[model samples]
Target: MAVQQNKKSRSKRDMRRSHDALTGPTLSVDATSGEKHRRHHVTADGFYRGKKVIDTGSNE
Candidate 1:
């Protein structure tokens, strides 16, 4: 079985894990809906950027 030869120091281990922290998804405000949504993604109402890209058919 493979095993670690030396004990990893806490500082070194923490430093290595510095980049492992989870980051929140990037969100952007929709110009048409004025709602926050993930970047490059359409809003719940099918609005992308300032234009309507999809017809959700919720009006009827």
Candidate 2:
């Protein structure tokens, strides 16, 4: 079994957890589709950075 050597102070504990806050995914707007998507990722219609990179074949 493991045990803490000393009681940690609230300030020290909170300082340790300062960077533990959750953050939402970073998003960028598509120049062509005018939609928001994750950075460096293709849009739903396969558009990336204003250019068609993949053929989603959703148009039927």
TM-score top scorer: 2
Off by over 4 Å in 2: 58-60
Residue range 1-60, candidate 1, lDDT tens digits: 999999999999999999999999998988887899999988999888788889998777
Per-residue lDDT of 44 in model 1:
93
Please list the residue runs of candidate 1 whose C-alpha ends up more than 4 Å from where it truly belongs after superposition: 58-60
Total clashing residue pairs per candidate?
0, 0
Cα RMSD of all models vs. native, in order, equals 2.1, 1.8
Evaluate residue 56 in candidate 2 and report its C-alpha lDDT on the 0 to 100 scale. Answer: 90
The estimated TM-scores of all candidates read: 0.83, 0.86
The sequence of per-residue lDDT tens digits that candidate 2 reaches over residues 1-60 is 999999999999999999999999999989887899999888998998789999998667
Residue 34 of model 1 has an lDDT of 82
Can you give the lDDT of residue 21 in candidate 2? Answer: 96
